[model samples]
Target: MGGFFSKLGLSCGIFCALVARFPLSAQTKQAQNPVIFADVPDLSMIRVGGNYYMSSTTMHMSPGVPIMKSTDLVNWRLVSYAYDTLASNDAMNLANGQSTYGRGSWASSLRFHNGTYYVSTFAQTSGRTHIYFTKNIEKGPWKAVSFKPSYHDHSLFFDDDGRVYLVYGGGKLRLVELTADASGVKPGTTEQVLIENAGAPAGPNTGLPAEGSQLFKIKGKYYLFNIVWPKGGMRTVVVHRADKLTGPYEGRVALQDLGVAQGGLIDTPDGQWYSYLFRDFGAVGRIPYLVPVTWADGWPVLGTGGKVPETLALPASKGLIPGLVASDDFSRRPGAPALPLVWQWNHNPDNALWSLTNRKGYLRLKTGRVDTSFVLARNTLTQRTIGPTCSGATALDVSQLKDGDFAGLALLQKRYGLVGVKRTKDTKSIVMVSAESEKPVEIQRVPLTQNKIYFKAECDFTDRKDVAVFFYSLDGKAWQKIGAPLKMAYTLPHFMGYRFGLFNYASKNAGGYADFDYFTISEQISKE
Candidate 1:
């Protein structure tokens, strides 16, 4: 027995030595800054056992609040969504000349309790607060409950005593109690002010007052996190702590670097803490950043030495491409979904007008109704455009297009750019449209003779230099630049980052259709 044990110990030592000598890439763990270099913002994260789940704001996009899952804090993948359609209305449906472009859903708060998961968000367009709950987080038929009075930038908290509450509001923070089931406000519970001057921690002259509230109870104390932008200053993080849920709280400035604010706290299984926040990175929009957290005399300290670090001790990210945003061949096997979770419609889509099985291995977008412009067009499929730089290409078949049909690839935003085949009564022409101002203008138009063509849009967001260019190809290998360059701007109307979209719309007729063979994405721009 002693000889056998000695041999086992010697083998273990040899294995350790070999592992040290080899040092596999998976064993090398060091994460870089801006953990996810994509436009995933307004984050609310929760850790269950060894897995972490996050819910973020997607504004007017259908399947509104996106839920992402990650085992390590660095890499994440989309798991599910909170709701399919926020509401069946004119604006949400993009009908009657009204659109919910930037006003559907705002910040969301996610929590889990008693084996039930809850995600709450408020929409200014709907003018209400929506709370969705389910037993299964990944595959869920979530049930919803809505109430009047939209809560802005709220946090859903479940107390130890089985009471539920919502801490929310703007410069002057407020609190309200919910029913035990969290369906609505608790009876006889009056809404009251929690902190009179929540933005005072950052300074008195505040421009964007203290908002984006996230509340937590850690070790018998209630801590509230918020973001504030003082006059002539950048976005800052402020924390307010109290001995009780309702009390005279003490406030202080937590993190004031790189405009990386507006998120809450999360901890790992190994007991390390982090603050998941975001920064405004030009046209790519708000990208997530993780700052290490340490407790100092019971207050959580954010960042290292008052600054966001360039790297972290967590595992290295495997990248977001093909996971968060993927190239779709529109091919599926038996009993498979027609569209993947990475794709989202601009708004509530007209499902009957778009299909994958219409033509095998092709996404056929058939026009259901005639519309005036691209923004008003229904059933526009989209994917978030990622950063430093990225490009999306698609092979379009305009053979089935009818007169007055416009179908192609585009970078969809308030100020947009697109390259597509436009059909008229007598001829077919390839046109490039740019909406840098109040109205869209045809920047360039070239007559086309082929039935099939490829279109691509490349976006450059390096160092906040937001620019995009369009290109077209006849043979799919060689590409030609077309149209004026798009000076991409993060406008208030969109309230989100630019997205690669496949759009088909008709101006004079409604029976036209466009077939897309494949959509591909690369992290490199063509000019690079």
Candidate 2:
């Protein structure tokens, strides 16, 4: 029997060698772990069947609450949007050209219960909360349900006893029980589980209000996780657990100070749990960060050891989970599409203005009139800056534009911090300029005609308060100083990091479009 087994092993080895030598097709590689999907913030995820569904706050961008689907914890793709029309004409008219940076939906909660999917968001304009539900996740003809505004960062909690509750606000944590129909709060059913000024280690600070509440049950104890802001600083996630779902809960710090942390807990089928956190990387705005969570005593802890871990080795997911890759080379591949995960717009996105077709090998952006207000109209393709010190490069050809046409790259921080190349018919020259809050101050204007120009912007976020911006004309050639390095700290009410992208603004109508060869973003990793 030993001799026969040895012969069988040798025969199997020979067979494997032959198969390798005469391979039918290229072997598919297993997806990498901790796949980075940049700029996805305030992440709320739920496991449905064998798939994971996640959603984040869309702000003023149309199609609010971007719903993403994933098989493994990592590798997410945009599936659908919760709100079809983000802000209608009526909603925008109410905004009145003001920026809704902190006012829009901060953090949103997504949950699937009893074969139905539910999502809730805190709309600041009306000072009211709205919940939407759909029978199917992908194709959502979502119906909206309105309630009194508790606060931003709202979440839904379903008790095991067939009762539902809504938890929201940070400073004054409000929890109200709901009827089974989820129509309105149960008659005479209202409770304030945690008050901001009452039970805090330190007194409640101004501006640094608490909000973004989430409830989870572990080890038969219910934990209420929420964000707390302490007197002019970035908000952090904290938790308080109680023996009963609704009770006099004790507040404890789960995640503190450490940059900005939002989002909540998601449990995999295998019982492993993780919490999503957001960090503000200058020029990247707030990007998502995942941390392994564990329950200690009764409080929850994030990261590996109180410190936020940059990367980790996650357990292999049981089945195949898709990966997140918004990068495009424009060389038509089997599954490659023009639409990426990062592109967003105010109001409904016009599909006619953008496309990836055989005629244009690059992403062609049609020139349109600049929206008088940044919040109202700006045709820009942007992605979050995930690293403090990162660089983005893109190749653009604006030769088709007549005078008064401008197309270039930019590093955006809300209404300010825009640096790029522009072209006007006056001189038929491509000028490099920087805009701080939509005020375009000429930097360095250069001439380029009928040639595809390469543009790059590097943001030194080591000192985000004083960010430096530099531009390069070609891939690896002469680098020119565009303008005086500007201080970005005072640009907005809340100073978040910068975002990079390609934008085209036309003061006068231009017949042609701006064609982009490609856009690439890279973050510098600290050696430590």
Candidate 3:
């Protein structure tokens, strides 16, 4: 058999060689700007040895504060998350009318000090500043520490003198010292106003104030990075420098093009510096951008010729698919994770309501209670929707769905759009619902005859033309457009980008369930 296969030129070594060559060609020698084209915003990055680690905000998404790892800074993959559930509350549980839709944990600061990895974030819903620490970041069983009064867009910094501090606030930045273990604020240390009018450097006319403070100590000088928005202008990068950890600090406007601001810095192993920031790119959310940095007369100048470049000297992108966001077949072997790292719940999930073991090769989401709207539905497994265009396709097994159960795929935002199977007492309908207005309006409904259904949500964020359309099919091969185009907008209420989600919730009765066979994501949108 081996000799016959060799004669046909189908040897195992030949097949393995072809597979190895594909991945190598996927990553180019030079990197591209907007390093990641997903909703990875408010980035805080750190370099430990040759590896670069980053953390980003995912407000209201449980398994919050996603930690990502990269070797060349362009190609990254999700490693772990800081917490499984941020807080256990009525809002987090999707109970009552209260929902932490846009008000969960905000920005996070990731740091490594003395062999311990630390990530800190603040939550308005929980009203606390949370600090999580682990000896191992990749495989973390992190321990949590909480304190009252959450800080806004704070940076956790470890000074050279062994003192830890948190620099935070908006417009006017403030500072507070943390204890040795970073449990709480140091005993007698009062919150001091660090930079009074931190936004002043940008100009007198300001729309969005300076916030998202990330401080770094480079070459014995303290450098502070913040984002400021000038009136009638875009999001801008402002930097401050101080000889001491505390003021008096001098400020300057760094990079203002393309509204790409609000992140910190990371250095390469070979001594090259880069500014890590994000741009608010419509409904696709705030995508990350990498700007080359150079020191000019003691100041770190951002971008090339004072503009964000489209490409860089670093390694090229290996793409975000199967890394930042991926397709899941819901099949897992023993000892493997129930869901991939790319997936996150809409909010704190009810562990008892979801399982991969209840049925082999399927994700079973049982409705524990009734939800009035799709936004309040629990157990909605989600991943970031990427740009310039992408589509999320799912095969749902609705044979077990009870009356009043709704199960399908959704493009989740404040004003969301969904294509799913909605069952009533007498009939099952394939419905397309758009919540572009105040209430969810069922745009179209077709009678669903079969138990198994295929649903897809295609999003186009090209040139900031944010639009999404829903499609449904009895067979996975052929699709029919179902609804009015969803005019995707970046609303402040959600505070995050749109996510492709698999959801099942009850409108009237509980205990109804839906099984998802698989969720597949494609970088290209398919035409019906």
Candidate 4:
């Protein structure tokens, strides 16, 4: 009901009284910056009723365009995806050495119209613009329709007169009116350039111009927010305001701290305004940050004193379980999703290859093709590895694995690492492989004697000094450290964070499958 300081003061009061009974843990309840510490980039968010809903880009991953819900804008949980799969081309299917690793879907725009929740995004790989609408946002049977000619970094705006408009484009901004149903642009209604160079002083830079346009109409004035990277400076925020929808507009730099720019404004029910933007923080990918906004001279100014605050309004932290991150047991009910919302495929998944009910209480991953590398392996399940440190462990039932099948836990990227079981025609062994700079390197290997081998990958992204270490267990209680450390990276080639992935690929043969009993993630400090 109050700010973080007030909540902390109250907790301290209760702590003093309970000191004689129990000891308080060391983790603090302070709300920190980079509200979400994972790779939730190109964010588009909206507030509905009592909840804040956010949509983010997941690129080539199946079940793309993740929609997360948060009550306090800091503690977000994945709710649904706009599409189960992009399903447009072979690249989306990871076929023929072609993959949509970094080019499927990018920044999304989320909005609530009347009673339906709408999420719109364009995929560069698909060359299409998709519009999804649902009456229920959380659990949705979203009706989807797509059209040719993709719109880049666009915002979906519903005008007061019930007209639909798409505010999109590069430095020379354009607004195209849509049909009454919002299915497509009105025929013969040519686009209008809304703003020129967004009124920049040095004009738009050719290398990194003004893009990611989000439009808003507040209190009879039209506002456009965009991220502009000047030729020699850091990422900047430019806000253009016009009294009419088609402007005649003037603009200014609104917020520009720590490269946190390119997002629109949202006001709470109680009238508190905040800007939800993201910052590029090295190999962990672009992390989202929420900045408080204040109205000055009828214009929204971002950040306090033009500086990013370390601690903002604190929301209740429920420690990333059953919410942002989950430890799956692979048990499905009568009519639930085959996998939890927290899990996504590395690219488009082979729907028939993995199952939860195939073997009760276990996840069965069957290989459909013979692939030499993990990057080309389809159906490698993945989830974001949160910072400062977390360990992802899985109990692998390798008794049924075929020869040439590699099953284990992975920290997946263009350059990645894995601690998994490699089964041959007659033998099984545990091994570690990593890719630091050029390509994947075999760091270490250990011969295994048991069928149920446990693999764990501990990732540390604290302060962006990203690194990962591998471990293995035979009894599930005693752990042995193995493999050389991995320098986790956020490379633009992959355009994603280091994710804890469950990968099983075939090399020498196909039809080899592995059953994973469970995957567990917990906070841990590296023994190093």
Which candidate number would show the highest lDDT if scored against the true structure?
1
* Per-model root-mean-square deviation over C-alphas: 4.2, 6.8, 4.1, 5.3
Q: Against the true structure, what is each candidate's TM-score?
A: 0.96, 0.75, 0.94, 0.93
Least accurate 10 contiguous residues by lDDT in model 1: 20-29
Comparing 1 and 2 by lDDT, which wins? 1
Q: Per-residue lDDT tens digits of candidate 4, residues 311-381?
A: 77656366666677899998888888788999999887888898888889998899888887888888899
Residue 118, candidate 4: alpha-carbon lDDT: 90
lDDT of 2 by residue, 122-233 (tens): 7775566767889988877788877775455667888778898887665677778877867667788867655544226333563556666777777788877666666655
For every model shown, the clashing-pair count is 0, 9, 0, 1
lDDT of each: 0.93, 0.63, 0.91, 0.85
Stretches of model 3 off by over 4 angstroms after superposition? 1-29
Alpha-carbon lDDT of model 3? 0.91
Model 1 C-alpha lDDT versus the unseen true structure? 0.93
- Tell me which of candidates 1 and 3 scores higher on lDDT: 1
Write the residue-wise lDDT of candidate 1 on 346-382 in tens digits: 9999989998988999999999889999999999999
Off by over 4 Å in 4: 1-30, 199-207
Q: Residues 7-124, candidate 3: write the lDDT tens digits.
A: 6676667767977887654554678778898899889899999889999999899888999999989889999999999999998878787799888999999999999999999999
Flag clash pairs in model 2.
170-210, 170-211, 283-497, 283-498, 283-499, 284-385, 284-498, 403-425, 404-425
Q: Which pairs in model 1 have colliding backbones?
A: none
